[model samples]
Target: MVEVAWPVIHATQVEQVIAVFLSREHPHALRITPSQGDKGLDVIVEQADSTYHNFQVKYFATNLNSSQKRQIKKSLASAISLHNDKDSDFDLSLWILTMPWNPTTQQLGWFRQIQTDLACPFSCEWRGLDYVNGLASKYPQVVDYHLGNDKSRLEQRIKDLENFQRLRALAGMPSADSTLVPQDLLTPLAEVVQAINRDDPHYQFSVEAGPYAPPAVSRPGLIASTTIGETQVGPFVTFHVYARYRHATDDRPLPLTIHLNEAALTEMDRAAWQDAIRFGSPVTLAPGSFTLDIDLPGGLGVTNGEGTLRLFASDLQAPQPGPVRWVIVGPASWSVIAEIEVQNGPATRGVAGGIEFEGIDSTGIMTTRTRATPNPNGTFNLNVTISLAPEQELIGLPVAQALQILRFIDAYKPGNRLAFGPRWEPIVRDSAQLIQIDAGSATALISFLTDLNLVSNECGAPASVPNWRELTRQEFLGVRNAARVLAGSTARLEVHESYIAELAKSDIEMLPKGEPVAVTMPTQFELKVAEQKFVLPFTEISFSRITIESSDQTSPDPDRGFIVFRPMEGCEITQSMPYGAEGDDSLE
Candidate 1:
């Protein structure tokens, strides 16, 4: 059962390889032969230069494991045992022959197992292709580089036929006797293997023609519109409050709530008015319009024409001002409507304005009258007059400075009621000291502390009038002198000959540590300027230790994400350290 054709082919190939090797060693004899059944040796070759080699040819188109190698070692051991009786001296080099290959981990592990279990001397495994190439390089004359060129062609043809048969089975097709594959079939398979070799399964036609796809975005459209009407009669100028709301395309309604002023409510019947005009009333208007109206009462019940009935349109009224904010939303058809803004007028004198101030503690002041008037409750009326120069008007400073002045007064005095009066009011009405100004300029501001009185000195007396004793002058002044001085000095005035217009803008409030306080502006005045309409969704994403450095670990680029360190969150970044990759000792 020799089936000896393959051995002839292998011997011829070995002959050229041995010849090539002989040329490297001069004056050497070389012989290559097949296995002799008596000795059970696969191949034995002798060199003329007192050298010899033992050969083993492995013809496998697949991988080898540890167990198979162990079997080969067992056969070698048996052959050696049979030859133990003969006395001979033979030097040997073991040569292995196979295709161009390197052993995988499993195959290497098998070779290691053979060494460990069988106690073999050689621990290294050499590739057959490398040995052949090395031999050809060593003995160039006998190498005959093209000796295996025709056999390689035949082997390649056989491999091609086999691969086509395997693929035909995979593709649910029938294999034929034809050796050449169809161009269409071979082209596709070649492309597939190329893609696989490139490690890009995504490029495969089987994966690209999948059924899944990303969802499409949808645009919003106008959904619905409605109208509302109200008509009534009464004697007084009645007040009506209507809530105008809109239902979004998604069916979510945002109701509007507006509080009526005292003037508008004073003349109307509170009981009857609240009954008809309830809270959360929907606003309905003509089609394609966002308008609504509620009829008001006339002088007595009027059913006739031209009766002067108060007509109140809900759209005519502006939203109540808050925190001095302003905004404009539009559909691009009409002029921009200011959705938020403060009403600027002198009417805010008695009423509250956008600016507000609350007292922190009590304060005091003194007058030059040197007299105390008695009241109905027998409590003395301590009137103080803190004077300013004729040109020193106090109505020009920013209101915030005025507030700080009030706080300063409170720190000086513990419990004193205060008010800021006009310049024409008594500067020395009751018992007060005159604060003579060394600097006569109108814009000259009084310092918080001075030589005469420790103005803002927590442990010292007043700077304007220092002689007064037994009077806790800190709680003496009724008018807010500090606020007045602040309002006068730091403030800018828009003078119109008769009346002064406040033009000075207030500075942002400073926290204790000189940081700007995050105060919420009034809903009426905040502005959102964006390149395009973008909704800032309600999301809280926390960023922890953005400046993390791990030279020993792998990390992606820090600048490649949500940019955790935003400039606005008060992240006062001066410099950033460079990031190093894992195992990168180049920086060293």
Candidate 2:
């Protein structure tokens, strides 16, 4: 075999190439166009004497087999009539069958037999592979016009791939070269993200998945795949994070850690706060970008939140890759409550594309930071934190999602310190089914319960569940001036700003924290708030001996919760103090 630069070509395109070749040969070739009636010849050439020559072009990528030889004889048989229009029958001048494939000895013999059997008056010829090759050499420009050479084809393919990627990207679709992800691998990734949620200190976490488009895409690649292990070209994903972190005035990447294996959610995992995707370790993160990877069954992915992350490197294979990404979206909030977003939806617009949770608190200034890493399961881990102002309410979120988030924070676990305000307080207590709300206004609590459909206008709890038990009017008000007072502990009462210009709880008295109070007591001492009768349970008898305390310098006793005392006769102070004393046990 001699080496030659002959360009490889397609059989279907052979006629087109031949058309150019023949048209070039006879500048005035009378091409039989579709607009005209079907002709026995693909094209015709005029001789000087006005006689015509016929050329029938056929493309056969394979050798002339028996069936093809028979078709050829049939095709040639039609030439018995006039070879030119208006020419008498049997007046065939010349007929040529042009085909791309060379004929074998048997095929040539068959062709000779067909000619002998037809016994036509004019000559018969075959413009097979050898003739076509000689024609190509003689008219190289025509070949180039029809089919480009090797280098041109490669360059064109590159351009095609780039153009396709550009088009898809402009349309917000995944890149043509995008690495699709494995669906089963996504389970672990989703689990890892959940682990980030369980382990990270983000007030709100979410994921913004990049497109998981398969190899089923434009020009250079197949638009749809069926063969096994031929998918997951790329997986582009993003994880979100949000927290309240006070960064120092310097340029430094955030700190984070990620664990891939699914195991117990303990230690910082908050033995009580873990899920199926729980667990992680610590790692450092550069401000704007970071690295991510894990030993996944397939390949890798990319994306970030409130910031950016780039994707490259890794494997992506598994039948067909679904658009699944586990992202730790950072929840956002401007007020007391953060929005807890629902997760996981359709592939096109997963996360439902409803609301984005990027953990940004745009209250006054923007202080969003991020941290991300990868798991061994080809999933990712990301965390974020923002700057928060002092005095703002902690944990303002939807009740249900709030319940879920609360279960994972440091405050919910032992051997941990929960960050609040400027200090990290040691969280010595924990509970799963209970939450403490210290809103002094019963009306506010009632409104909240109403919003959640957990309570009625009359403060009646829903259903027979003891957790939602009913509350009495007086008890609905946070225990003011009450304490966890032991027998020796001193007690104090609080006066709140009047709920109305002239209304107060009558028969006000000392009570235990969360203790139900009586609405009326005939013998209770009363300090009138514009004449709304008020009473204290233990104060009527000690009215004269009771102390009226303020922020005075005389003394400050912290343990002031035991019994309640009332004001002196004719001495009225309408202030409803959740505290009238500065004590550690002050009713708050």
Report the number of the highest-TM-score candidate. 2
- For each candidate, what TM-score against the reference? 0.19, 0.24
The clash number for model 2 is: 53
Q: Model 1 RMSD to the real structure?
A: 43.2
Model 1 Cα shift for residue 375 (angstroms): 99
List the candidate 2 regions with Cα displacement exceeding 4 Å: 1-10, 34-37, 84-91, 151-588
Q: Over all chains combined, what TM-score does candidate 1 have? A: 0.19
Stretch of 10 with least lDDT, candidate 2: 347-356
Off by over 4 Å in 1: 1-32, 38-62, 65-71, 82-88, 91-100, 121-127, 137-588
In candidate 1, what are the lDDT values of residues 1-588, reduced to their tens digit? 101122335545554334334323422222223343423233345666643454443433235555656545664454344334355344443433332234677765765665476444322244544554554444332333324332223564565567666666656654574444456466656754443323111111121211232122211221111112233322222212111112110112223222333343433334323422432112222222222232211111222222112212121112222222212222222222221222311111111111111111111111111113445675544333232223222233332333333333222221222222222332222322222222122111223212112222321222232212323433222112222222332211121112111111221111112222222111111111111111211111122212211123222543221111212333222211113332221211
Candidate 1 residue-pair clash tally: 32
lDDT of 2 by residue, 93-131 (tens): 778888766677887787788888877667778877677
